[model samples]
Target: MGKSPSVGVLHEDDCDEVKFFEKPRKNLQSDDENVDGRPGWLPDGWIMEVYCDDDGTIYRYYICPLSGTTFTTKSEVLDYLFSEMDQCFLESKNHAVGSNLTRTHEWLPKGWLVEIRAGGDNMDKMYKFYVYPPNRVRLFSKDDVLIYIKEMKISGFDTDGQCNTNTQENILAILEFNPEGLPQGWVKEVVFRKTNTGKIRRDRHYTDPIKNYVFHTKRSAALYVETGKVTIRAFVQKTSVHEMYSFEKFTHLHESLWKRLELGGTNQLRTRLSKLRKLSLKEEILSDEQGSTSAEDCNSDNSDTAHGAGQNKVSHLASTTVKRPRGRPPKQGNARK
Candidate 1:
């Protein structure tokens, strides 16, 4: 059997060095937090803290902008990150691929952050980052845009209707930043305008002094800002023609319109309206064709009489009439006698 190798003896200084190398630096105050040695920077509206456990698990806790608090393990954070920074990295892998694209919004677990260049001549004045899903950051003017650069899912824009909880998590984020942040208006007017649009009815009779309209309907309806006033048009059609008022002219046709609007007017109510208008135009065309056809038939009959067929029929009718008028006079004379 081979003899075991002799173990080397270590000095006190060597022992100290071995112990120091084995011991991790307890950075209670330093920026480096995790295994990746990434420095942590917490944004103004967020709260970041570490959770450590004996089983070698470390969790990063985030206060969600909406619900107030959120937490994920370090492994989970790594899973969600898109990029690796000096001290921190993105949770998703595809984040770096879309760094050059604009209007590309990133989806975080709790909310989303979209980087936007403010509109017009002053391009560099400031780039705006709008956060959503839970929109925790209430940004002041002077903050660095990169402070909130966390991992986000780079998905499409939010073109759907106004979001409630039912909307997709990422979609809600983009919708929150539409028009590069909500337009400057009262919340009421903005919502009202959004909900109304093509759903509102237009008054065809009056071209001048256009009137404003306000309206609503069951389940699905539209309201609009028109003629400096709000107009609403609702309709649902299945069988018998029925229409309802923009404000009060409720009827069969209106119900049909509303129903059609609800089922089909997801993002393009105008397209739906265009289809309906086309149908109306088609009906008008059919009516005009029938009228013209009838007029042409009548004219043809009249002209035929002037030529031969009508005259021949008239002659035959006269021959069959014989002396009916004279026979009536003779019969009356016989009765008198």
Candidate 2:
């Protein structure tokens, strides 16, 4: 008979160290008992075979039942199992979506589930929404949900074809930040602006009371408060005098204020404004210097005028007292006659 290939024996080059062992027996019992009569945490049908070297060093190899693949560590087996579970979950979600079995949210694509659960502790009667995507990953916030949806679209996983404009609007409506939930002294502001394409885009801003900075998103506000650094896009605007009024009045502030509220909420506006102030200061200084120079010239002119007047008076006295020749002396011939 031809020689049969041995199983569960890894090549020496495959691992850092080489180990030799006796052929493992077939039909092993439970995973725990199969591991040299020791308790193991491996799932059913997984085999943990022990090996030894001449130096009395021990090595363990794990075998996957379904694929007959060999692994050197328990973590590898667990990772394989998790990957298998994810595949299975994905298939199930696809099936559910095709059959219209899963509950759908107006905002989310079909096959995605949204669960509303009553909040615990201080939340009391409040309810929180938890989203479950087709991948079975639980999402807790609107930002996370949006990110997941974006990734799905990028990966071509939009099975229901419901990730349309209306669905997006519904999602935004549901996930919109509630101004009433803001902390004391913190405000939420929304500014509607037209893009270069003339599409109306709504920008949401959150104020951090502790840092006194305005962030474009709540996550950014929290991050700034935690790190003491503005890690995201932020804007600086003059505190409005109309802040005490109602929201409508605040929104209706001067048109110039709206212009200041545009995007690029980083140091761009700040640096630009600073440069303007510096230019204005320079102009003012130059004007002051010019004024001082003109004043000095005027004073010198007045001094010169006074001095000339005194000289004129002296000259007038000389002209009246000393009868000096008013005209050139008579010609020499005329004098002789």
Candidate 3:
């Protein structure tokens, strides 16, 4: 197999190929495929290369075509690729990896942050790619990165507590990363916002921008030529709102709690709680004292009745005899009533 990670034996017909490989290609099957599951086809843009080592044992390799994945074997690449499960029922259940590589992305309303690195045990070898749905573009040269961010369909990228301007230059700096630009996510909507002409005209808006029309991430710089009036329709998704349960909760609570405490002239939450505790304790003590005084007064009032009344009281008792009917009765003392 070629040193390029895009190595695997797949039938040329089994997997989709790039427009560059228009001719017929060979199908290189791998032994590393699932035992029960049939071997999958090569992915488009990727090619399979096979060569025997000095020891005659056959080894298969799956390589990423856009390059830079450390998967040394076909099995490794298959594991990652099969997550999307390339299958076709019409092809006798033999679903090979075939994707429309040239298809534009159905851009999300927002963007995501993607981590890219060579496939394998390599960790330090990493690249960072950011996707801005506004442009339907990726900032790196890795297929897995593109596939990952698209599949994730993240609503938006994190601001990371830092506010960065989405200026025209900033967008261009990130999107147009040298080499050659790869167009993935498709831009479905493009509405032009005319300058300060009182109100936007209905028929003046445009949906399709010419191919050469440069795309920018910023909405304010919608117009290719800055007439100061905004021409492009750039609607950035609202920044994600921090929920009540988010860390902002603690920050907000901290301020409010401190303010409430400050009104009481105490600056500590613990001190405020302690004051409440003392008030509660004092109330409990007062209630206990009142209950004790009431009990004492009642006891003193009942003392006279309990003492002299005992002497005036008299006791009486009587024993009754029971008669048994004609029957064999027990020889014990007559039944007492």
Candidate 4:
């Protein structure tokens, strides 16, 4: 038996010497979903480098051949790459010694290998690369490829919260962090006005500016963002906001609860909890205050009535027997007389 080929191992047929990928590259047709899942526009031949903030917002710079400088915002580039193509997928980052690399993202595909670049500035600072259809794209580079694939295989990204901008109540729920001292809930929600603009549009309006959410102890939480503000519904549990902000933590919890779920951690758990709160009213039910009533007590009370009825039936039968003897003797005596 032969061992599997190592990372970036190229085959003769797989090599594409073309410096640029032909736009609308022949639709990727394959028998397998993983092979076919990627877009035809994504027929390999791109170099990639991934970076992230301490807070966990990810950025990928690609050496893609495609040309268009109009994309002013990061969201615009991502929207076109991941959402538009459906062929792109993200690569995972390698971990340092004793460092537990956490999978916080739900967007990228599973079982993807991590490959890093050699010392660029610092040996520690290497770009993460994951190649899709490993058998398909040929890696032919000791030299750097100029154009790169910025992002890929995105499942979800946030758009701005659509709160009524005019209202002071601030329909948008804002989540902010105070690293100096943690708040009571370890998170706080306050009403404030924010400017809404065309910079990043999810639909016609609204943008979910990615924000930081951290938990101090598994219990205490923190949220921080440098440029934009996030508005969340007030009373949105600190845990809920915490889950949203800390993608890595959220993914860990998700995997622990339901291992059957796919490679990415579930947003399902968060969605289910949200729907539960929304469906229920704020009013307290009196039954809740009554406290623990056992099934034994209920069964005993119901059994008592049945026991009383059985006793009454026995007494009535006994009286009928006694009366029958007396009535029979009188009837015989009266007939003889």
Per-model TM-score versus the true fold: 0.22, 0.23, 0.27, 0.16
Candidate number with greatest TM-score: 3
**Per-residue alpha-carbon lDDT of model 4 for 98-126, expressed as tens digits?**
11222232233332322222112212121
TM-score of candidate 3 relative to the true fold: 0.27
Cα deviation at 207, candidate 3, in Å, is: 33
Residue 149 in model 4: lDDT: 28
Candidate 3 lDDT tens digits, 125-190: 112344555556544434444565668443433334232334221111121111112222212222
Query: Candidate 1 or 2, higher TM-score?
Result: 2
What is the C-alpha lDDT profile of model 1 across 1-337, one tens digit per residue? 9999999999987988887865564444222555444334443544566666786556557552322325454443443232222111121113223322211322322233332222123211212334443535433121222344433333333312222223121110121211211111101101111133434332211111111111232111111211123334532223211011111101122222233334223457677788999999999999999999999999999887777976788899998985644443456767889
Candidate 2: segments with Cα more than 4 A from true spot: 1-182, 240-252, 257-337
* Comparison by TM-score, 3 against 4, better one: 3
In order, candidate lDDTs are: 0.34, 0.49, 0.35, 0.32
Better of 1 and 3 by lDDT: 3
Model 4 residue 98 distance off true place after TM-score fit, in angstroms: 48
Error of 2 at 316 (Å): 61
Q: What ranges in model 3 sit over 4 Å off?
A: 1-41, 47-62, 65-69, 85-267, 314-337
Residue 132, model 4: lDDT of 37
